[model samples]
Target: MSYELQAVIGAEAVLRKVAAQQPGAVVVPLRQGFALIPMTDELFDSATDGGRGDGLRFSKLPGGFERVLADWSTAGPLGYVEAGYAGGVGTQRAALWADGDLAIGPMFVDVNEPFPAIGSPISQVLAHLGATRRRRDPDEFVAVGLDRCRDTEAWLAVDRSVLPEVARSRR
Candidate 1:
């Protein structure tokens, strides 16, 4: 099964707010950063159905901007997970992921305005998925070149260094 994760960046003001709120979380400047979401085909399909498809959610940490980073999986058909903002409201964004050691996927430009928030519902979803909150150091995020997904077989190219860059550029 194949799954796609998206990191959306909206207005610069919103991006700045996100950075300020979660200084330690990954933050890339508008038109300069990306968001990495990982999932399987089954999970992705379920999310489209308004169900708890994958049992994972990306959440922002309390007292700062670090998102509770982790993975979530479930055994039920109705169980699912959510990542990113709720009701969408800010920043220009991009999505990235890896295939073994290669990065391949879509790099959307001029994303939708008023993107979702990284807090609230996303946090609740993460907890439901049993994800453990781990502080992702700002230096840990990196940057990489992303290509558009041509077909289902395409994989997003990513490097370990890219993770930290995603957070650093926001500052």
Candidate 2:
């Protein structure tokens, strides 16, 4: 099946700060201490200067968004990752923010191409965020259980009972 995902992945603590700032943001816990906030149309419209579209230009994402991620780095690194696949071919982009700065990358990877020695863009961010690969796991994506869902919308189906809080304060 084809896969697609676009979201911000970070430690639950760090994402809580994001949720606080972007009302209606949901913090869906993953394996380990990490969690993800599915980037919705509303969030994109509110955060970007370029208006919503297919690509993410961090410069267009506004200084306020970066300021929140910067301020919460003590909790952990945060990354925005987008991936899309069809018929086994896909593209992925990822950027890591830690210690109030861009740490790893806003790197892009062609999933059907030979991956960099380090791994795919998302795996690099996941590795930086402390995800470890298990014997049967192909990469951090699967190791963190991201492979369980083909898209962010499906991932958002996570049981709310596990989340410490889900921001529903926005319209």
Candidate 3:
């Protein structure tokens, strides 16, 4: 099976567990498995969605693949739309900026393959926890290895914890 399909399946199981942990959240099915967003806003409009890019409703999936971050078997890059689709996916994967800004996906472009940990936006965050060195830090200063953070192919699940409660609030 395609890695994307595997991602979807994997996402389904994980998000379902997340739903149990996160009150008000439920697993909403997509073409493949499912994504987790609040259950009440299942029919939300894509145009006005602010949580992610245009939001993360499965209902907003483009009929045909528009120019998106990456191409994969059946499953696609599922992340905040504006950030993932705007111009470039930027250095950050899902960062929230002060100017009402948010970055989008490092979509599960390939689940079977390991992510490029050296210069990815996620690598930048790892630097902040004081748990590791910046990717740019001298090779000798590489505080901690990225094996724990990197080495995953799937785009991360929609982690609402990163955003404020208002961001997750229904529109």
Candidate 4:
């Protein structure tokens, strides 16, 4: 089944703090982690227009970024740690920052574009493919130029930078 992630409870205060610090960003929760989506005119205008197919639940992409937190949520394991959206007709991309130490993703686009031609990595992380362990650097975080995790079109954009800070900030 295809699943979408949602926000978490009790994370509102921290999300608000992060939002205040981030200015144009809105905090969203993935089953695996959290996302920091930017508040742009294009984002607000494009989400509810049925650009994606039917049953595409955009409950996470609220019309307003500053709306009050609600208490309803789906009970399940989080699929992504965070996510980023690229709003457009041809490339309505959803870059999902998935959770777990070994997860690699964030580059889920509406259209399939060639890799290594669209993005740059935030940092590098250790990856395990079956029994092999190696370091996919710089571009690991960026999906376009990423070498590993090529099959899923997912990159490790958020592995190094955000996860640590999120952990520290929680405590």
Mind sharing the TM-score for model 4? 0.23
Give the C-alpha miss distance for residue 153 in model 3, angstroms.
30
Q: Residue 158, candidate 2: how far off, in angstroms?
A: 2.3
In the range 41-107, model 4's lDDT, one tens digit per residue, is 3444443343322222333444422121211112111121222333422222221222222134333
Per-model TM-score versus the true fold: 0.22, 0.80, 0.22, 0.23
Q: Which candidate is the best by lDDT?
A: 2
Model 3 lDDT per residue over 1-171, tens place: 111111111134444553453333444432223232322333233222343323332323332212221222123222221112113222223221112222333233221344355534333322322233435654211333212112122223334244332233222
Against the true structure, candidate 3 reaches a TM-score of 0.22
Where does candidate 2 clash, by residue pair? none
Q: Which parts of model 3 are misplaced by more than 4 Å?
A: 1-10, 39-171
lDDT of 1 by residue, 25-125 (tens): 23333113333233334323423444431322232111111111111111110111222322443222222222221121112223254323442322322
